[model samples]
Target: MMPLRLLAALRRMLCLCLLAGPALAASPTGWPTPYTQVSGTSVDWLKTKGWWPLTVAWQPAFAGQNATVVALKANALLSRRGLDARFVPMASGVAVNAAISDGSAQLGAGGNFPLTQLVDQGAPIRVIAITAPNLKHQVIVPTASPIQSLSDFKGMQPPATIGLVLGSSAEFYFQAAAATHGLKLGRDVVLKNVSQDEQRRLPAELAAVVPWDPTATQITTDLKSGRAIDVSYPYNVYQGSFFVREALVRDVPDVALAITEALVEAELWLRLNPALAADVMAGQPELRHFSRPLLAQQLAEYNLLYKLSYLYPLGAFWGRQNTDIAMWLFVQGKLGKPLQGADYAARFADGPMTQVFDRLGWKIPARPPYIPADFWMNFVGNTLPAYDTYLTMKGPQAWPEPGDLTKPFSFAGKVHTP
Candidate 1:
């Protein structure tokens, strides 16, 4: 060698260049080799026989409800469970719905309105599980505005302009509220399309805006600039749903089950560690606009509204809610044609979630419960006691049994250490 020290430095530089070349040039089409084994299957089988790195479209628009996405990004859930999946951040359920329909994403999570729209389009999709119900969407007004309720907008001189993303669940909620208060779109108030972020600061000309949390939460609590005149509940159930392609469910049952288990476990993890989950969400670029304290509040609100359950409640309450929304949208001219909730409910692929519950040794409801026709008149508090009874209870109630949510929960015989 010319010099021992120089020769060693040259070797180190060569190694650095070699590593940098691949990193700069590599465009990965598949997950790395030697995939972790899940349910006796590996990425070897997935690549050769099944779909590898299943593309999951998750919406940050849902805020804290999408903690599962946050966990997946941190490689805390799906990777830990040996599931080869990629989490794609989407702007809203609207985008997620399109991804699922176009075959870009095999799995997606969306709210009631987008899900209904996707089903109405006759896409090859299925509702696998309910993500959450009673997610609060509200009609918010600036603190200085004189309008105290939706009724105040009725018969305005120029028809107050309400800001909201058109054809969104926010619109769905606003419409329901308008109808109840004897106001109609274009009659009492006009529409101005605005993103949820824009809704955080009500524009000068806009009278009010409709946005779901944590935008709504931020507007009302964190920013303290707006107050909600009306809310989604008692008008719309507003269930956020997790849906998948029928082909994925039919072809790769193991993959589907693993994904569901990961999601359920992620939710449990959020329940046990709301603060940590909030911190994770704050780190996401899409959600960076929201502070950790606000996210913590959103998670707290979610944990308060719904309990952890992966199984789809396929009873009349759910059926009628779905049907009612579909019918309403159809009549509102938002949909091309009318659709029965049963038309899509028939496709509720509960197999994966069912397996998750079975593995946990939890009692699964054998039959869907029936709800009286009038129970929906006051649907908020009118649900039957046994119909998804675990949902309303606090602190993560285990179905038909009590569990210690204070302790760590496990899946696949592995306790969640994080």
Candidate 2:
């Protein structure tokens, strides 16, 4: 009884629905069903698997980087390619390391300090890329406190106690700074491990709080009662690394490559659209309460230091820096023994990162000459007698000479041995 035109329309509609049925059925809950097929990419693999989920362990503190990843997910970049990506928030780098260790997440980003600590502790993880460098940490004191500089700590009665998160870069820098000034960590001062919130509530007796951004800025801006005494020892060259489980890097390289590409693309997008990226980050649920201007300011600061263009060079440099940090830790008595440059390099998997850059036609810059230990010591303007003494004991042969970064210095299986 239906008209000929209506009958034909009904047939077309039924055919279209039938064609979409499999895609709809294959898509997991809350994921878009791709109508068009993608080929020869990570997304294609996701489509083949019916849009399986990929989990990334994330820290909220890495705002700009976090924003880019979130943007990728929100835009259905992965879904369109036939996969779902999720970011799971973690409290600290330690938590991220634990999650990766237990197989709860495959990818994570964290400061070089904790990452180095974990690697030295024998976690089967590898840093795939150095995403950013020059992250700042500050030592702050109550505006009225008598402790004006590092010199005040020497031979002070009742030894000063500085509040900081243990195993954090803040702690590492604090120890380094104290050592440079001839102050023994346990004997000269007390390091009380405190949370960010606890840092604000530090009693009158506490000497200072050593914290990284947001918390560092918050102490000065929001509290208005704190003053930054000194920036961390390294001063504008500390790094943050993107890490993956060793098994993932070894077993499924494609997934690691895809992640590196995604990160690089996200970083590029952020750079090209800074204002939009800042606004987008401000709207994130975790960051919504923060002022848009504040978020934007933080974004600007991050953009200045971290550039996707220098990814490879930065990774190579940080690989060497990580060993330097390990040696510093050893001299501080925190680490059992020094880590050699080669063992540090072994923890870095550069294959996936190089592949991503190649696919994008990005040129990897020539590696920079290695900065010797004495260079950093002079740069910080603090003579580390203990560190100097330790090097003296090891002799010149054990030290990595300038321009020798390319050659891997052997540990000869002596790592972590007391």
Candidate 3:
């Protein structure tokens, strides 16, 4: 019962892979045994779905929605490159892990943090690629807010009301910033989850806001309206990418390779097609009124963050930050247990990502003005990724209604929940 669009996309990808795969360079990793060939518009693979033989790409771009990027990538690869593949949608990082583990999904994106968590817990998930790494999730408040510094929250006094997601990278840094300045939540400040309607108003009612998943593109109206202002997180605390079960990888690594190639093309399209990027952002009713150009701006900024992380530090993400960030989280008791630096990063597969970047000759960018605010975290703060949304900033993109995750047999296949 997957969305028709999703089913169509998966069918398209599989056909492309089957058709184009044989022409691909030597598998280097070899292909799965007993592969079958088909040339129909739809797949007969799922007719008897007890872990049907298939490769699926279920990574979420930007704010973790599928169907958009996956569909676009799947179609392009199928028509132009002949990659017979399937792109599936999952609801979350947790869901992606589950699908791959359960065989409903062969592969999905899980990012460094989540991958690290699951791997440390001993799940069979393995990293096949790095969609993004070294991206710092920033913390932002209103540009004109009275909150002077990261440590100023200590004065908010009993039940201080601020806004941010409780378990995200934003909270990780907020906690770090507080500790660095000797501030404590519950004793000094408290967090309030904001609704879309309340986002523009939250800055006005609260001392300041630290939105991990902010709705507004920037603090322009909030601050211009004399509501509040904006500040940015100095560094990121949580990191995430594509994960697949080790068994699937062992059985069919070419699917992983093809997916990596398709994603590279997709990311390139997203980066270069700023004026139309929103076309690939997928459906999220909540983002209906959000400006496409603004989302594009956020995506560009997020991608640039990736460039910074990739270029400035370890030269590649390689999950080092995962160790640092996870270590910080564990010490703060955000995570259940302590994980070793080596153990945490062991889950990342930067080789694939690095291969893609190297093939493209990409390097960390020079400076900030290199991108624009709307194209960066100047809006929703750090939670917004820095990829380029292909859209004209002047026009607004209507939000598409997302599939109900609660339903059965959704396009998520056995993997929709991811």
Candidate 4:
């Protein structure tokens, strides 16, 4: 018997799917018809389990997540692949997590902090794929500020107040950088929770603002008033993950694989059509204020590490990073109890991504391609493989668009127009 909450969610899902039937039918690829098999999972097995329309809770504030949403909205991948889904945009990871917790959404996309919190609270959630592994964050100060670096915060008469969307991956980066420089929150510095708009203003009261791109880009490039001191690369390996309810992986495994494949295709489309992708992002209300060129820059930076040959892997190091974050949060009293990486290690579902890469004819990496330590040391003596090696590892899909990033980079049986 299904729980009452889940039953209600299913009913809502069916209603939404019914309303979206016309759109699905109108899709250029058409809706996914009954395939005998998809990614080794029986199509019949999937239908019997009641996996129809899915509600994805995604935050549009982040660049990569926003692009993926734009791709999903354009029916770039989901509909043709037999996954009937609607995307509900959330303001932040907290809202996405809430939607997932209440069963309103089956899959949620968020950064490391939110994913870690979900696992720490013992939600029946498992991370399925890496959406944006190299997502960047920054600590920026006003142009006139006396502060030159993270080290400047030490021994101030009055503790400096830092601004950020608290409890976010920005906070995670700030914390890591602060500790590296021996600065402690509340003693050496104070934190003031600021919204995205507040960060943009670069308020005089706050000594520095920690934000993710294109917000960071906007502050530095668009506004030209803030200068970033410490970026994400050397401080933290900022990552975005798509996590699904454990039941989805357990029952409708094929659906999970389709979701992962759709993400890969969507990102590929994004990489191929960055200008158009930026236009799509600028179409969003919150992003309307940002210029098209700035948006494109954000897209390029976010997609730098995403490779078709390697795709994104949910491997050992990613698990270890999450664990380290969870432990750090717990030690900082952000979480009520101690939680290790092992606590959530079983939640990482890498097989579906492996299958997607297999179909793409790309090499499946044993772990994520880059880490903070690798960036810190410039990869001179790192044991891990470098980005150049991954870039050269392309398969059937790697193309050099004559003018456009290798001729609009083909995928899913059609040349992308926008």
Best by TM-score: 1
lDDT of 2 by residue, 147-238 (tens): 88877888877788899998677877887778767888767789998876677665676898887776676667766779887776343356
Model 3 sits at a Cα RMSD from the real structure of 14.4
Q: Could you tell me which residue pairs clash in candidate 4?
A: 323-341, 400-406, 401-406, 401-407
lDDT of 4 by residue, 1-418 (tens): 8899999989976765554333222212211333213443545554454444678888767776777778777753666776667788788888988888777788888888887888778787778777665676889999888889999999886999999987777877788778878897778998889998789999889999998877888998988999988776654566687888777777777877877877766776676576778888878775676888887776665554444433454546666656657777887788877666566676678778777654433555554444323532463321222333222434222332232221122244543211
What's the residue-level lDDT of 90 in candidate 2? 77
What residue runs in model 1 are displaced by over 4 Å at the alpha carbon?
Answer: 1-51, 310-317, 365-418
Tell me which residue pairs clash in candidate 2: none
* Candidate 2, RMSD to the unseen true structure: 15.6
Estimated TM-score for each candidate: 0.78, 0.72, 0.60, 0.76
Residue-wise lDDT of candidate 1 within 1-418, one digit each (tens)?
3899999989976765553233222112112123334765445556664356778898776854566677666755577667667778888887898888887788888877887788778888877667655677888998989999889988998899999998787777777778778897887899999998778778898999999877888888889998888776656555677777877677667767767776665665565566777887888887877888987777766643343543354533455567767877888898888877576676577788777665444445433322233453544532222233223444433322234122222432333211
lDDT of each: 0.67, 0.62, 0.46, 0.69
Best-to-worst order by TM-score is 1, 4, 2, 3
The residue ranges of model 2 lying beyond 4 angstroms of the native Cα positions read: 1-52, 186-188, 233-236, 313-316, 328-337, 368-418
- Which is the winner by lDDT between candidate 2 and candidate 3? 2
With candidate 4 superimposed using the best TM-score fit, by how many Å does residue 285's alpha carbon deviate from the native? 3.2
- Residue 30 lDDT in model 3? 19
